[model samples]
Target: MHIFDYSFLDNGLLPAALTNLTANIYALRSASGLRREANPKIFTELEQVARVQSVKSSNAIEGIITSDERIAAIVNQSSAPLNHDEAEIAGYRDALNTIHTNFKDLDFRQADILSLHAQLLAFSGNDDGGKYKQNDNLILEIDSAGKRRIRFRPVPAQETAEAMEQLELAYMEARGNANINQLLLIPCVILDFLCIHPFRDGNGRMSRLLSLLLLYKKGFLAGKYISFEEQINLYQQLYYTALQESSRGWHENTSDYAPFMKNFLSMLYMCYKELDKRFAILHGKKVTKKARIEATLENSLTPLSKRDICAILPDVSPTTVEAVLGAMVKAGKIRRVGQGRATRYIRT
Candidate 1:
């Protein structure tokens, strides 16, 4: 039986690095708030991009995937799911939408969790939705040679209900106390949920959906305009390393929360940073499109791809970006690296 208590967070047990990350996120949150107030309409496009990215990336993390065109159509409800994978993708889109629409009224209760799981698998028609697992499960790791090993043993089905009940109660109790930072609390609760592995299926995806719901409820709105799941998917190896480290000794209540907390906060910080870039690009209507593209490349800390530039400057046409990159490359202001889909540009 695992016990869930986040009161340890109140004692300033967080490492200095995590504390800095949290503080940075808070500062970024304030800036994000001001930007939202200043340009509310600009975020509509971002919201739409994030919605598709969240659905696609979250499912991709679970190995559920479809073509980008089909995913966009599925996410927008413009096309019906044409395969099993697309069906699951549609289900995640709906579940994410439900959280976005109704998070204010939702709680950490078992019923709420079950409902979200049910919605997550509804399109795929998994009967296990909205129900606890009736059998035990294991988290397995496979090596390159295809050998499988038990990564972690989750709570038995017989004990999952009681484990979940205690987890929700503990989370709510801590969440009510002002001493506990909700940012820190969110990861802890999510870690426990993964450890419990309540549903036979959809546990990973449900954790992500609940993460968005909890963050929204707590005023971490970066995920609304930037896909947190996409960030997780991008840094998936780091994500799993953090989860693996934090879940060690989780059953005995000796697990350390710092790894996962740091990773989680870092992802949120990235979302905010990305939002800052998006806002900066959209805010500069005075700059010419070519100038903006040039500046984006020159100022980037890493190389930028045509696709990356297009995403960062969503209002810009790809053809225009392509032309600017070509002119810049010819002028020796920037250089192209790699070729084809692997292509990227950097300041010369």
Candidate 2:
């Protein structure tokens, strides 16, 4: 087997999914134009919201949860951890803050990775933070019956360091070549890292943290305004399925990376799209009764049903809302999604 090789990049072509994803990325990138196009105050507010949601969702995915109010307090540091879960949340907040503040200076090397892990679990009583697995770790899925089955076998503890080195070397070598897209390059490395299961714990959180870092480095600033971790947590099952599918046969270097890549790219696209919608509402845009219905739709990060829009604009008549929605749809400013009562409209 050709371990740690990036022979997959040789084709100089992308698969259909990636090709489509690349096109979407290009369109959104062009739409974004310059960062200055967004209001500074709006961006700052959204960034803070993203931070709180990201830390909360990432921890919640691992079944570590606290009340939304508590999460906010812990994240804002207005309060201390009331329990173990809150303490963990606090640790994540610190690590995420560090990454946000210093990602440009952080290298994607073993030392840095370990350090990030250490910071992630710093408040926890576990002394094993920052250390690689001293024993084999099993990837498992527990059913409702509490039954656990091994999902995949990671690199044994003895080979953990070397495997990590090889994985990073492969990514760095490929990254140096401009022919490969950083978008594709980053996810492949993440898939490999997850499959390797290099750390004893916090692999999932690390993957998400590294995702933010890699995206920022590649100039994908969507995560700064929208919480990608929250998206993944919302679609948690899809995330796990993509990882499981992409990781199959990984040890023999024969795994397909597309599933996870698709999920990653799609989440990124959603983030940007959300950012666009949310941006329209910010920057002191005044709404009138005439534009209230349309503005309400534009203001939401997620698609809104007629009832949803009406609830936000209780003063507006349903007839008026319907008329404006029809005009907007026909004018191509927004389109209908879903069906009937489930129908929602979103800006095109």
Candidate 3:
């Protein structure tokens, strides 16, 4: 005898919000492409390095970061008698690589996405891969005595599958309409998924990957292009805080997702802004070899050698630097002193 209130669907605000979010995403993508076109070599090289680093760091922190040091270390090192870390990292990397390579072809279906989650959790080495929980999970809170206590209980194990199915169905319905903002839909699905606590472990990591996958499917690949996970690492505390805030009293809880949504949007915006700035610096205007070398020397506090210059300016060849240095010496932008490996460049 329960009646559902569908007023939120009729308000028209959700559709409008989604439209604006999609438009902004497109504009950001165009700007990103323009920057890439301007500085293809440097932008591509730095981006790949950054992405790998981000993924590694995020995977390392996993469950250990949230619970206890011993637990964290065990989870991170895969030495806690569980030994699932390697498997988890591999699965996550595979999922990421797949998304990066075939972003456009992603169809956003439930089973396919769940399989990715299963792959991600395969590292947990648990038999629950791609399956819902069979028993109720407890949300634990720590007391002053350092004892763990159950704070909130979830729906029964038998009902877990049904709950997840409903959430997935809602997600599909929302996605199909296209008129609904994908941004709103993203956080909604993420929060609900966490609430379900579908898998036995690796839920947090899977949730994050799912968020990125959804974004890639919708063309917000700019975040991945510049390492959104790195940005999250920088604000790890806030990241967890937002998750905890969203999940508090989640069941029958009139909790507002505004805080979590705000943080998510802010992180996305920051990543795009940083990428934009980097693109501008790389492609804004071309500087001659001499000018570039002089600028590099002046900006760096440490003394630079030929090898260091090569590392910093990967786009410029070693022979090119040697040629540029010879010209610069004649032009007096730098004075090379000493001999062989001992030689160093100082701004004149």
Candidate 4:
């Protein structure tokens, strides 16, 4: 389906969920604009932890096995991968690092995506890295008896390049129209990408990498501070179910995007919520009430009304919350998302 098709937006993604996702996406954007940390060390520490978890969780989803300690060591640059699985894990870490360092400058074009895929599978000695599948591949599900059956058939090998080119063009065209929010559009695009299954291997990991890249490009930075892949891994079965549900009739351009979009948005919301709790734990004791409030507002997954703040911080008075929120709004640390009683505060 092309970007102009109504199915992209009207195809069953819940309206309520879309509204909620929009708010969270905006909140994350505001949080990314946070003042240079009062202490950069804490965030750096968390970033490393998040990176390790992301690498571990993403690789683990592919049945790649290694001790947590070893993964941590590999991520920390203290050790080399010991086996084939660990080597693939290391490749993931390297690809992730490239995304982390260059997401700002990267374009989600065919060559860029292929380059990351190559980087993602660098451990493989053959030349499959960064290349489309040269032959048809089946997505299979193995039964309890170890009998594997095809679950889906993707675009034919010869059509992979043309399919991807059209998909990229569709996305670029959609992006030019401001009415289509990229957050919602991204999940749909990922769903189509998975259904296409353009590459020979590593499609799952590549999808997650693309998720982070798109999130960063859209100005939502929660994936960096909290592991998006980890959150998805926590509910891996649901992840597959959602993808399957959304891709049911994808080849015919008659499927629902809601299932996967719901999962995607839920995963994103979890990341922001986790970021809030982590910040409160790491900085609450050291920072003042106002700073804490600032952190809360910035880290919030949704715009929080004054009553919401009071609810979250009962130890602090309503007056204190009000004053802090007011100050934050004035200083551009946060913005009031609505007017009067309906108003809720979010990062600027």
Candidate 5:
């Protein structure tokens, strides 16, 4: 059996990948700065929508079952569903808001990440929130015939804590080394933590939040403007397949994280690429009123009516605003609220 070794980091493709990634990231940062100035409002609206979607998908993956209707209601009506699940969805929103507000200044410890997990599961009435699993855990596979099967199981409970501690130590060591690429280290840490399966529930959601926090620490603030969760949600089957591939033979003590790592890198690159496209559009000289409105809604605190939006830009004609709103509403990018004079508009 080929036992996977952490020391493989000394020989893996990580260094070459990190160097290339760093260069790309630097270029991306420059492009993003230019976009921020060129179309500030659109960028802001995109960020807001991204943040909300990220939180929603992250929670949903853990079986929280947040519906599109519930999310739409939250945004449009400030009204929440009366059901228990809806309450949990509301908690997710609250947690996401807290994370966003403090992400700029916060640095997380292992305990902090665990606590976030607890908060994430609290809405689902899972009491193990913020606590590590005390018993042995297993990943199970169920076939179409509904046969019970064990996929992967962690080490004995006696060794679980020590294993987790070692993982955390590795994470901290990499985090403190300025020479190490934070992006590479973050996914590694997340992979290892998931392998550990420390918490009884909400492990998946917590791992994602940890990923965001790590990215934020590395100055990947653009993630807050876009979601890894949204990407994962769309490719959920692929996501699970990658995780399974990485963990295959883990019970036999094999180390093969290549598939998982590759998937993660691909997702990250996709986000970076998308942001690049948006930046390009922003910097282009032929910006339309529709584009400007999109950016403004992305950044706006309160959804605005056409008149309210026009109030902000005295230079833009009301006819232009009306035209842009009509086009956007047609495009399904913005939803109109109320009728006639009492109407308002918000990003959809």
Candidate 6:
């Protein structure tokens, strides 16, 4: 049996770099809390934007996708799923909604985990939704030539139940320990759950869901206003590379958790920074809608789409945003990249 122990987190095992990263994340989290308290209404718009982005990006990560309009409709429950992909997207929306609404009462217990998986596949009507895999599964990678190779072997089916039980217990114990930082313990638990691969499907999505749940429960509420999953989707290569690096030597319990831990922390840090930036653009001394739009594009770490600009400046109408963007492009102050749905603007 593979044993799960997070006692290392209480010790000096984390690298200096990770420690500093966590400190920065903590400071940002605190600042974000203050900002939210100052004006909760401003974040209401951000919450709506993040909800759509979270549903889209989390499902998109597993290759489940639909049109952006359809995704927004599904997430908001204004339309029914028209196909298998849409159905899966709806399931994720339901699961994410449950966490965002009820995370205060949720825990890392096996039953709660099972219930979440059930909600995750509620629309698919799959019998395996709330159950563990009855057979072993492999994490696979496909090469360019279409060759499939086993990336990692998860816990055997017979041992999965016990493994999950132990995982829950380990997380509960670590969470209860004041000596442990919940930030560090979160990634370890997620990595272990992935190694277990409790379900035959939806393992990857569940891990992301659990990531938000745990973070929210521990006062890291940045995911609520900024899509943590979107950040991961944007930097997917780094996300997978971190998971691969940390999942090594797992069966015998010698795997290093730092890679995934750092990745997780970095993602949270980005979410907080993003939340701060969005709020700053709205509340800063820009004084005019056009100036705010320009400031948004100027300070953005990534390119901004028209819709993104509208979200950041909810008071600004889309028509105004479009006109301003066109003017900026014509003036050579900003450059437009991609086309149509992929179009985004960046400062030149």
Model 3 per-residue lDDT at 31 = 83
lDDT of 5 by residue, 158-271 (tens): 666676667767667666766655666666677777777877666677777777777777767666666678778767889889898888776566757667776776677666
Collision pairs in model 1: none
Candidate 4, pairs of clashing residues: none
Q: Candidate 5: where are CA atoms >4 Å away?
A: 1-7, 10-26, 37-40, 73-77, 155-159, 249-253, 280-348
RMSD (Å) of each candidate, 1 decimal: 2.7, 6.2, 9.5, 11.5, 7.0, 1.6
Task: Give per-residue CA lDDT, model 1, range 1-348, as digits (tens).
Answer: 887888899998678998898999999999999889878877876788789889988999999987667887998899999988998999999999988889999978999999989888888878998999999999999999999999999999999999999998998899889988889899999999999999999999999999998999988999989889988997899999999999999988899999999999999999998888777877896899988898888765345678767877877899999999999999998998888766889888
What TM-score number comes out for model 6? 0.95
Q: How far is candidate 4 from the true structure (C-alpha RMSD, Å)?
A: 11.5
lDDT of each: 0.89, 0.81, 0.63, 0.79, 0.67, 0.90
| Residue 322's lDDT in candidate 6 | 94
User: Ten residues in a row with the worst lDDT in model 3?
Assistant: 1-10
- Which run of 10 residues does model 4 get worst, by summed lDDT? 1-10
lDDT per residue (tens digit) for residues 210-305 in model 2: 888887877787887778898898788898999999989887767888899999998888888877766665543466765767776766556666
Order the candidates by lDDT, highest first — what do you get?
Answer: 6, 1, 2, 4, 5, 3
Candidate 6, residues 4-79, lDDT tens digits: the string is 9999999976799999999999999889899899988888878988998899889999899877789889988999
Best by TM-score: 6
Q: How far in Å is the alpha carbon of 111 misplaced in model 2? A: 1.1
Which window of 10 residues has the lowest lDDT sum in candidate 6?
281-290
- Which model, 2 or 4, shows the larger TM-score? 2
Q: What ranges in model 1 sit over 4 Å off?
A: 294-314, 325-348
Error of 6 at 281 (Å): 1.7
The parts of candidate 2 lying over 4 Å away from their true place are 33-38, 144-146, 288-348
Which should have the higher TM-score, number 1 or number 3?
Answer: 1
Per-residue CA lDDT of model 3 for 1-348, tens digit only, reads 011112243356544544555466567777886766776786765456445544555675574222222332432344432345545655666666666677676645557667777766655566787777777787677889999987556566787767767777767777777556566667767777777777666667777777787887876766665667766766778977887886675776465565566667666766676566445444533876555665666544234567656655666778988887787788886787777755878677
